[model samples]
Target: MTSPHVAALRSVALNVPDPDLAAEFYTEVWNLAVADRQDGAVYLRGTGPAHHLLALHPGEQTEIRNVTFRARSADALPVLAERTVGAGGRVLRPVAPVTEPGGGVALIIADQDGRIFRFVHGDAEHDVDTAAVPDRPVRLAHVVLNSHDVSRSQAFFERALGFTLSDRTRMMAFLRCGSDHHCVAFGDSDRDSLNHIAFLMPDLESVMRGGGRMKDAGYPVGWGPGRHGPGNNAFNYFVGPFGVVIEYTAEVLQVDDSYPTGGPEDWTWPPGRIDQWGIGQPPTPAIKEAQQAIRFMPAAAF
Candidate 1:
């Protein structure tokens, strides 16, 4: 059998204790517009075409509900279902039509690793009005997963989904389905958790401007305003509502099939200052503790 062909990182759903606060943080701070909202959930959209890039659902604590991905086509859904079964992924729900913000069909499935995956097809697109929205993000860049065994998670994603290895460092691995260096990555951890969710900024100036905006609103950079070694992306990070680490990144290295896949520790790019300008640092001890103090969000919140 072949791997499931995924195109883009659709949206990430989080079951946060305070959906209202979480919703406000993304809307007011990140500049994501409130696409829609009901009693227990709120959908947020960037200046891009997809319905909502983030979903905040009511829960007891802050935890990821699911990560949604876009498949190549309507027919691709059946192929994904079949391949998922063969790989021990149970289909939480079979394929069905959906007419939500992004009109399309979607289904819930989970791999053996316990990560819930939702796949969508035929979703309506959005045309960002840049002149009207100055704070809009370019797109959802990538999400880093903290896994029990990074290798196991990496292999499952590569072989089960059509994700290719974009790069690897001593402690992390970047996987990509498209040219933008990586749409998903994995980091070493004792339990499954989220490392961070990144949003693509238009340019370096936007990153600084956005960071300043966050600072003005009382959220400071937990880490970043740095340059990474693998993807060569300039990054600035902050802790959002529910203690979730969010990042604004620009100039993410792009790669195609010909991009050399290196051996262990054979990263393509040379080591540079964590901050290209030779300044900035990683998350502080307090921020690290807050991230490590994640509370569980149950699988079934409906």
Candidate 2:
């Protein structure tokens, strides 16, 4: 009966100052091809099969130190690491499997904002010939965070990553881990690192052909071809390549368990609820004038 959320996001490690220009801007805006590189780390994957989803290294300073996921085997990862230390969350770091020709069983974890999530168990023998680049990349749905206390980081990923809550406001919150409405999301306003990382496109012309290939690779589009209102998906936000805050969503909003949970959609702030999925479009006034020329120095102001 081992199953306390079997990990599911295998790789997302970035420390890039310039790991080959963040692997050539994630292989020219999300084609994600390179799957290996040594010591100075660089491994990306997405054309299919998942041996990696993105990892680059070249740190000097610049945060978002970690975020990984994947847990469907190895006997349910120590019962999901004892439900992430019984929900108070603290497993700092651990490592073991390094095997490669497939068969999966990798691990890495950290939460409560040291933020890193990696876990693999099986499947990823390597694929994606793409016939000649017809198009591929169908999973790894969402990963967003910018929490000082977005309701205790959305109640710690809905209590250690089973993640089911679907909508909210007071800054923002939209969670879902296994069914594709959203894999992760959190925003308590006051920003910094880890704010975007989503992938799930099959419609809206593949989110306007991946936002017109990240606007013809000039790269700079933080926030939406627009449509939100909580996981109604159809979103877009960019400024990736090492610092990451990228997304390219599609139709989101799915629920079960009768669809209700928590009060005020669970924390007030619901107005038109960020457009409630009517192709809202907002956020790119040059991404709010580059987040109003950043000055938010909190975390005890360093």
Report the number of the highest-TM-score candidate. 1
Residue 142 miss distance in model 2 (angstroms): 1.7
lDDT of each: 0.79, 0.61
Report the alpha-carbon TM-score of model 1 versus the true structure.
0.91
Q: Write the per-residue lDDT of candidate 1 for residues 1-302, one digit (tens) a residue.
A: 12347888978888888888888889888888888877678988887777888888888778888888899888888877777777777787789986456668987787776678889998877777557454468679998878878887888777667688877776788898888888899887787888888998888888888988999999988887787777889888888887888889888998887888655556433474444555787678856766555533444532
Per-candidate total of colliding backbone pairs: 1, 20
- Candidate 2, residues 30-128, lDDT tens digits: the string is 766777787776777775566776667676643544555667657766666666667776654444665443335655555565555656666454664
Candidate 2: C-alpha lDDT? 0.61
TM-score of every prediction relative to native:
0.91, 0.31
Please list the residue runs of candidate 1 whose C-alpha ends up more than 4 Å from where it truly belongs after superposition. Answer: 1-4, 132-135, 267-276, 295-302
